[model samples]
Target: MKRFFAKKVITALLFTLILFTFSFLNWKVAYPDLKVSALSYWTDNEQNKWEQLSTLIANVSNTMSDKVFEKYTYIETYGYIQELLGKNEINNFEVIKATDGTLHYTYFTSGANDVSKLVERMKRLNQAASEVGSKVIYVMTPDKYITGVTKFERGMPYNYANETADNFLEELADEEIDTIDFRDLMKEDDQYKPESFYKTDHHWKIETAFWAFTKFVDVLEEKYGFEFPNEELYANLDNYNQITYKDSYIGSMGRKEGKLYSKVEDFTFIYPKFDTNFYFYAQSGSQEIKTEGRFEKSVTFTSLLSGDGDVYDATNDKYFTYMDGNPAFAEVNNFNEPNGAKVLFIKDSLMVPVASFFSLGCSKVYMIDPRYYYGNIEKVISDYKFDYIFVSYTPQNLTEEFFPFYESNLPGRWWMHDCPFINWNGVL
Candidate 1:
């Protein structure tokens, strides 16, 4: 009995020591930030003493939490423990793992969001574009959670993003705004299935985006009388070199859930085997960067795949390999097909891969992510005068964050400049 009592005391002492070590490490990491925040309380005249104290406490608390030693390892270990317990919910249920071991972002919501304001803003944007003889088409990308296809265990939470998308699309159609609902294709089209999406990520797979690119071309040709030379050649999968990097990618949600909870997925890299050249340009503020060369050398960030470290690390995000991740504004000038359509895409991150694929058969493809862009969007539409404009967004992004045209600053036309590939004069 004495021996057992001694063992219990030793175990308790060791656990206390381990807790102290972790706490000390976290405090050390947060010390500098805490010092700065505390000092700012004296210097800052913007708020009252109580408010400043509140802010300082909040900052210190956040730093201590975020700067915890081996934070990700702790998270991964926690996820593994959760898996062992057959837990469906993780991270206070901010992320849920389906029975199939897929990580998904979800929240508790009672019903669909009010999308009427979003529709009105889109209508205004459409009217602005139409005034300049440019047609606007709202392209609804599929959400990761397909209504009937993805199933959660009993008593699991659901965020109503799909239902919200349904109402949003119906409202857009009622306004006489043109739309292509990819959800309908996901349900009816035999070619596309739940497999089209990434199990661990919110976005669809790169291969799925390539397939959607072909559909976009068909829409342009059949509905709008647009034509691209060598359309079939570009659309053919055989024309591209397909390389699959097995068990490489851990997507946005997967990063949160960790490797033990979410299975790593295969990332397939597809690019044209044909001789292709593109002048890629991206701009933010007064700064501009351009890459001009073959498709592999220019658009795709090959360094992402070749970089050192575990591919599952949140830093080595493979989904961002296309278009070098999202920027405020970017455009691709396709030299191979000079006579192709000049198109503009106002989109979210999901369309990055899709736009990259669409650029294959286009003379120029201008893309804007409103979430990051601060420019005058209406002015840009009037200035560029693209043949057709596509406003693409995933269902989860139907909020005002993606529709910021009215609030966008009229920062004057600063992008008009001399470039070797760009037609600043707007001549096709």
Candidate 2:
């Protein structure tokens, strides 16, 4: 019995030595510059020696751990077990499988509370826009899960998103705010097939956006009496250049779960067939760059096809191919509709594909993503003299910590320029 115990201790010591040696060699090869230096602990004469040594040890330990886990065999086994048990949530994303073997990501809600602050902010914005004769229209876009919930198994526990949106919309209506709820439109539209949203992505497909845009146009025409063109363009499938890539795309959610649990999905990119010339202006920091070109001739050209090289490449986000991802601020001047009205379209990533389509009805469309755009939103509305102020965002965005109107400054702080609205002193 004593011999057996002695043998086990020796074996454990041997294993520990081997692991330490392997980790050291790997770290030395990977990070040759991470050497012990006499001055490293005394850089600028204020650095603490103990703190530097502790940081160095922690970094090396983390690197070794990462290397070991990169090829760990148990990770795949653990993920498989989790999936089998229907416990496939990763971080804040819940991976729910549809009956058709499609994967959809449902983000956990951040709780619904008093959006009174947000409502009050919107009311102030409406009053200011009303003074300038600009109609403020709030369009609440639906999440993929909300519209595609029928595909999911009954009694899933993530209804907080729907509840939150409903509460906010109800509050907005009670406050006499003009809101166009696309959730109702999506529910009524027969075209909202299971394929309306991406199987692996949280965002709805381009076709879905087109359908929602049509409904929004209808609301504009009915309430504000605005005549919008290209009404039939979206209705006809022949008007779009559809490029399909089968079993080639994996969205943000898929990337999070890895290929083990999340299956690859097909991507169908739909580009407008009509000829539209677009002059784009993007503001970044203190510099503004302007580019004048056609839709097919610019960065949007990539939207016509998947990423360059093999279709199976998983590096590029295929959805970002449309409208060049999310820019801080962009102004699209559609020469095709020079006589159309000028509008300010504020939205999130859900509105990326649909943003340029607005130019078909409006001459100049200022697309501002409040999450990234730190400029004065109210000033932009006043300066542009926008005939319409359209706020389009998904329901999940309502629960976002960075939801636009919730900010005390209406559009949040301006990191790039000084926000004049902050110092308006009750001046409309």
Candidate 3:
């Protein structure tokens, strides 16, 4: 009875300490946010007050959790404990470590998604492209999990994202829409391995993305009769200065898993050795920013490579060092190669580097991440009349979040051309 009482007392003390620490760390951050959220809801003129309140509450909850003091410390401690326990899964297997020591995000999925709607949406997009004398090609970026490779211990969850991707591409093929599955190409390559991908993130490594870009260039040349000047030199890795930042990157999945469980990655920042000039523009809901210089100065976010702070810092996402994370709309104009080709990419974050490298061979490169873009894509297509349009998404991103404008049947909006942000003149 005495031992039981002692144990209860200890547990109570520990719980009290945690509560006190959290309150001390988060109250300042949460109180103001909550107050602003409440005030916004009060002033909001929207019809759905209840829904707004719910969303505000959810946002507040996330803020509280996120602002918790020493959150990474707690995560690291938990991850360390998980490691001590010899466990392969964490948080009830929301994240599973592969047998090869790579981390994967997964959820329970029974079967492949019915992608007929998505395929139809692509068809509509293709039709729009065809009307402007532009070609649409769906580039399927590979998932981290290679079918026979990327093994998990028995009884781990499988999300069937790969199966959905297979179904999605097959449907597109049946519709006679052109497609490129990087999975097939990667599998055929003798050099592609589990390590070709980030051990902790869904994204492929920079080198892999570069390789994909070269392959894409080949496709454009052989099939579309698209020519890139100085192809041999531009395609060669030796032509670029490859700077590898040792153990500086902690990917998205790694951020969730913590440094203790998912170790940091070595990030390679590659830039061209030859002279080049570019005008880069990015616009999102919150900000509009532009840069002009050579490839490194313009496209690459050099601050990320400064290596001044914690490598495990969540904000120090090295993958985003290229193209500075995905914006709603971004463009790159290569002044030297202005007469080459104009290309547009409807893509997810994976295509950031792909498009960046592609800019070298193109006069202009325009990119849109549909998740954040609220504009009329049909309008953009009609206006630009791009030489080629590539829709690139990782296999796992075969979801509606990546297809925001598909449901709307409205014609190209006249307002889109009038928007100050849209570049009517090819001059930056």
Candidate 4:
């Protein structure tokens, strides 16, 4: 019996060794040609060669797993079961079905560490703005769930995002920071309907953004004495040509849930009816492109119905149709408002539409996403001599570790390339 057991053990060990050898060989052949950059520490020295081998093995394993799940029927079945059981969550997003027959993507809340980091960043931002003699208005846009439009019960384990945002705003208030909590206005507005936000996406509908922009304009005028051209242009939705694509969109959230679980949503594109000329200079990576024409021609359109392509591509992301899909840095010189106040807007994806609308009030809008912008932001502010500085971000963006002011933490990254730490004391 001992002899038989020893033989079995030897066989098992040989089998394991053979399997590992095959895996190593497969990794060598299928390894991705990753760019050797400062961001990756593996490309440092010959001694660190093991790092590449390990990473290649991990990548191959993940690729194989993905292929398995893609073809396996049981994996999809399990995902469906998880969705029905309310256990489906991917990348902090879970599809919640509202009583109104609409699906919404809800995200997890910010932890204590995230909130604390956000508060610290905001304090630093306040000091930076003071030093630069720029008035800062921090705007926090609410998620769909924050307005109480969903049918789900409050205080669910997944519903703490609103609470996190509230806590952050409360802390900001305690610090006497100037802020615009749009969630309050959204909740108070009687005109807001279920359609105010996208049924299948995490972003608010264009109508909702327009409504919020109007209220924001009021705040700007009342608080900062800034004047916007032709409030009537925006006040009346009819003034803009509205084109609706029925049953057209499957948002970032819905795509994750798949068509089997999440229903399709509609998309509406609104453009100004009045004659306007906008010259946009957009820079991403090392490429810079300049375009000048009417709003429809000048702005990059990602919508399938935008007369760009023949068939509607399911992968066509319409969210990026605004401001050409959020370039790392962009400058819009509005000929319509030449000599108007120059404004510096730092924001996340939430401000895509808002930045376009801002052109009506400002001569030039310098927009940058700190996540992608690598240049020294302090230099941009000083060069433009911006009359107003607006910082807009959603609660989820606020909780991100790489929030605008904390870009220094991410070394050799997109936000830190060519970026310099501002001497707040020297500016003051």
Top model by TM-score, which number? 3
lDDT string for model 4 (1-428, tens) is 99999999999999999889866755553343222222232422234445345544654465554333133244346547756876534434456566565656564554432477677666666666666676777788876664455565454335466667788888888878888888777768853466677876777887777677788888888987877877777545677787777766767666555555565677778777887787777765434657777776665454445645311223366766677767777877778777677777788777787677667656787788876564567556654567778877776565563455643433223423343222211111
Reference-based TM-score of each model:
0.80, 0.72, 0.87, 0.73
lDDT of 3 by residue, 60-123 (tens): 7877876666667888999888888878987788889989899888887788778877898888
Candidates ranked by TM-score, best first? 3, 1, 4, 2
Tens digits of per-residue lDDT, candidate 2, 8-58, equal 999999999999987776666546334422233244114234534654566
lDDT of 1 by residue, 277-304 (tens): 9998885433466888889888887778
Better of 1 and 4 by lDDT: 1
lDDT of 1 at 114: 97
Q: Is candidate 1 or candidate 4 better by TM-score?
A: 1
Measured with C-alpha atoms, the lDDT of residue 424 in candidate 1 is: 35
> Which segments of model 4 are wrong by more than 4 Å?
1-114, 147-149, 153-156, 191-193, 300-304, 307-315, 400-402, 406-415, 419-428
Clashing pairs in 2: none
Where in model 3 is the C-alpha error above 4 Å? 1-21, 27-64, 412-420, 423-428
The Cα local distance difference test for each model comes to 0.79, 0.65, 0.81, 0.64
Rank by lDDT, descending? Answer: 3, 1, 2, 4
Better of 2 and 4 by lDDT: 2
